[model samples]
Target: MTYTHILTRPVRFFGFAALAALLAAIIFAGAAFGTTVFAAPIERTDVLIGFKNIPGFAEHTLVRAHGGAVTKSFHLVPAVAASLPSAAIRALERNPLVSVVEIDGEFTAIGHSVELDNTWGVAHVGAGSVHHDSVVGTGIKVAIIDTGIDYTHSDLGANYAGGHDFVNGDNDPMDDNGHGTHVAGTAAALLNGAGVVGAAPEARLYGLKVLNASGSGSFSDVIAALQWAVDNGVSVTNNSYGSSRDPGTLVQAAFDNSAAAGVLHIAAAGNEGNCPGNRNTVGYPARYASVVAVAATDKNDKRPCFSSTGPDVELSAPGVSITSTYLGGSYATGSGTSMASPHVAGVAALVMAAGEQSASAVRQILRDTAKPLGDSNHYGHGLIQAVAAVAAVGDSSPPPDDSEPEPEPEPAPEEPTDEPDTTTAVVSDISYSTSGGRTNDRHLTVAITISNGDGAPIGGATVSIDLHRNGSRIASGTGTTNSSGVVSFTLKNAQTGCYSTTVTDVVAEGAQWDGFTPSNEFCK
Candidate 1:
């Protein structure tokens, strides 16, 4: 669809239009004649066609001269269309004056993301099961680092606490370009009836505009925006843009800083698929080990053609024909990992909302809960499944100390010798490796084994174990060690910093327990 009378520009009156036209014709003819063709190899002519302000055209039509719109540059989009494959794209490049020919990609009109009302739950259409304890991502702030945002849009205004515009170094994130606005909307549009629903309706959104109106930005600008996201209260960031350049220190360092700060950074896997020329060159921060690279998929969970795919991509999300908020209080549909990145960001908010999940926790949950999408390379872990992800954060902490070290046992001579001591002491070795962890924090793992002397099997003995860390007990549990004397328990979010833990036997009194105390450390 075409927008009408979108923008108006003042015109200057010119009396000698005919004379100027005649002089322009003379120069045009001279340049056209000077252009030559080579029959031996390939013939090409670079002609910069300028469409003088045809009245009634919007400002969008007036392409900036600096970006492939100069008066004497070849029109790449039409050139590619006109030149036959047999002629080769290089034919257009044959001309010394011709630079790169950028095919003007077409964009689709988007539906209002407001069709579905808010259930006050963080869920997507196909998001698996609903978590009984709805994760309220309200307080967690997520930064949408992209073009810019229509922060004033009705559906997006409420969640938009505040943001910065690195492109112009301003606070207002007005989208002179529409790309960033849509991305921000997908990540956290207010659950209002005006426009569209976002993945995380309760999340606070920070708009970091790094690209100009043309949906492009310099590497420096993007890096600066990333730094801004980390410096602010943003715990998660979504970057939909990508570049063809190889990985650079500026981008890598930014990602590393965000990771070090325990912030989740999501980036697009670029638009170039498994193409020959650009195959291994995955997008910047996505390829960076620190960032979670997202790929695009359709509703049916199939990888989209335009989506960039590689081992770098961690997961895929619905990106094709995804509807979201646009500039000027409008809605638009876009298809790219750009759209997918926000989905993961919203999911991250949901996971974080469940509890104080670290960045690594959220990443692992997404990876573990993903629906395997055939090939691992294209979909990474698999399609992002929100419900399963939330559920994976079980009410209890994960099992601890898969590695059960042998416990040093003191002789349980108190038991009957010939009876074979049905009741025997059981123990496992445990230890903590870190020190000076987060202040007032605790982290440790325990290992326990149940058995009689001579490595004889001991069964039916209900042994209760408790962990006392930093002079305060953090974990306690009772279970029977089957066949092989082994039991494990976990304690999470106890306290910050290093703490020495001691194991206690609640059953069989004296001579019933045997194990080493392990140290666990916790930090922010």
Candidate 2:
């Protein structure tokens, strides 16, 4: 069962009514301010503007005065979505009623996965244990700002709360494509026992249709969704979508407003994989300080090749081969950081349901309890741990004071030694020793041996190791077991310091065997 996502390929939308009113502004904005629109056929320049404590009518008139027209108005967020000629942006910004203006950009939905077999993601993060305590994200409204949700699906309908459709301008936010439905399932699919279970199965779900059928949407629609999440007292908003470029000032401000309103906006770190430059390529709104950027990891706590890494990433989750709810009341699997983000969102809902309603507090709890992997840019603080987050839940009045001691790391799952048939698949022994101590000649050897109950060596087993120095992985390697079931990985040019190694055993037919990360400090 694979989970995680990215739905690339944005389709152009050109409904006659939405087009005719905005073409002039598109041309004007494009020509005047160096803004470019990838809009096909009808090039309309759309933008979201936050008003500066001004009357609604005055803000409306201001847009018209600059050759623009009001297409939509938000409920509580002092903002209006409109299309204006390029020349009008400066004037609108100059108006006392307008506080910020930004070009509406495009966005793509996403997914990430390692296997499509068993949906172990929910259990991997310890949601299984939290569920037994009856803290299943009940009453917490989590808005999935993706394509849309298939409320008709039996597992999701009861928890489905009505939402706005920023795409075609109607109340029905049903998902035309399957991306949003998948995201919804990951975050809050019903615990019906028949299909896959979600992280927060009982959490109220709202489908904010920002991305279109082609899995792409504009920045204005996203802002509208964000505004709705803020106005409605939504506990959390899961944004499993992103764009390469930063969204304009209006959207950024909207994110800030959402955070202030206690709406935890969780977003994908993007699937660009450091792009062509191997850079820190986290995208907006994940890159924004107000949003919790999420990175993707497989069940073994390994970062996928496509998961983007950067300073903006706040946490990681199981994204590879993650299986969850899908269109037509079915389940499907896919891969991308898009899938990883919703896991955190679901965990946030769980934290909120546990009585911590403050967004900052929830974020801090998540960070404090997360299982640290290594390297902030790659894995952030490490994979999100659901059990620890729920366990660390405290008063919602304010975040735990910095002076307070941080929570301890959650323990890994116990490795099963014998099968039902009494056949033992021993996880032999993982011994870490260092050799070659000279500067620039330091070497670290990680030996992993596997055997059966008969004490016979099991060959063909895969041993993947992560060498950690000061609790951070500084080097890693992969090796295969020999005929005697022993695999050794020697790190060349190893750092001259005490280091620990995490080894995993993939017993060919046993990819599920996530070797224990038994740490032993050995000096070079």
Candidate 3:
């Protein structure tokens, strides 16, 4: 059976009527940011290999990897130049430590790389965290795989190192359907004075156009882009589009291969709702193994009518009336889960920034802290909260000595004997790793611990792992703590170097939430 768990909570405004009536007074309190409504698969190529024994690994062989547990092993060999796969496998079989081996690959969330320029949306998540201290995801490279992004926009120009259009097989990834541009802005718009801010202001953006100008393309183009990203050094790959059909054996294989190389693959849940005519309809890539599918929700924490629903949706974010950078140095507001996917991708970047978190850690933080929407079908978790995401990263990290003193403990209020006041919950003491490395069929293990403010162990708390390097995600996993409040997961067959890992605390809604954020503590 597949493992299932809840990762986020829905954002619920308690008093809509009262709030609306007082809107005039609160007009300047906070502007109503535009909202948009929108909205993974797991696999065995999904299994991380052990480090004890790897086949076909030779010294000096350049190999890419995803989540591996052991970094150093006796049987492990560095990437070396050699065409003798048969000889290498035979030689490895002769060794007692050699058990199994696979080629290294990357699976990253494709995103748009460009200059950071934005307002309402940019700093929403990455700013200020105890873990990362600085905003997470700054100056990271995120690859956008869709129609394309306008590479020359003033906001995106300076940050644009280079990108290619897989659709036309050229360097220009200009957006024709406007979908890619919109998605790009949401992920990494330059934080200049022009439009809005991106989830990662300091992130470097790369545009990989898999979709055509009409907002659609063949699966082959996407596969090609995936290969290109792997061949190049892209860390994250964000896909904001989807279809209801299977991506075919070849395409799925391509995705699997890429993930093995250590790139994160993020996708959008299709916009189709539960219509009577639909039959098992869900978004592609979203339904596929290892993908982080996203959904859409409004400010009220309700699903928009246009947003799709299903098991494929991994999380929810601001999908309605979202303001982002548009083509030609302009800004626009729009809706769709297509708009929501990038926000999560940006959060993934932030998670990577905070610590050496595996893909699973980033995904776990998103789900556990996600505000649960009343309409669970449409809003998978709830509206994605940037502050909360950043906070999750912060909570999992320890504060620097130079930082301000910890906040004084608040006095516990007297409890009413009648009907335990169930509205409060306590969350405290969070920590994680800032891991960034490549794998090569070697096992890499990360140790984690969790506890409550009273120093009691917090059992059953969930943690996420996101393995990323060069601005991409390789693999992800989620695990829960045992009675001891400690758990360990192995990253099998990794490439090596500069990988990140993160952990999070998921408290029930009825208790007070307290903890240090694990935003940024590791990333080299």
Q: What tens digits encode model 3's per-residue C-alpha lDDT throughout 446-469?
A: 445555544555566544445455
Q: What is the C-alpha lDDT of each candidate?
A: 0.56, 0.72, 0.54
Tell me the spans in candidate 2 whose CA falls farther than 4 Å from its real position: 1-44, 75-78, 90-100, 111-115, 274-278, 395-524
Find the 10 residues in a row with the least total lDDT in model 1: 1-10
Number of the candidate with higher TM-score, 1 or 2: 2
Clashes of 1: 21
Number of clashing residue pairs in every model?
Answer: 21, 34, 169
Per-residue accuracy of model 2 over 397-430 as CA lDDT, tens digit each: 5442222122333111121112222132344576
lDDT of 1 at 511: 27
Top model number, lDDT: 2
Name the 10 consecutive residues with the lowest summed lDDT in model 2. 1-10
- Indicate the TM-score of model 3: 0.51
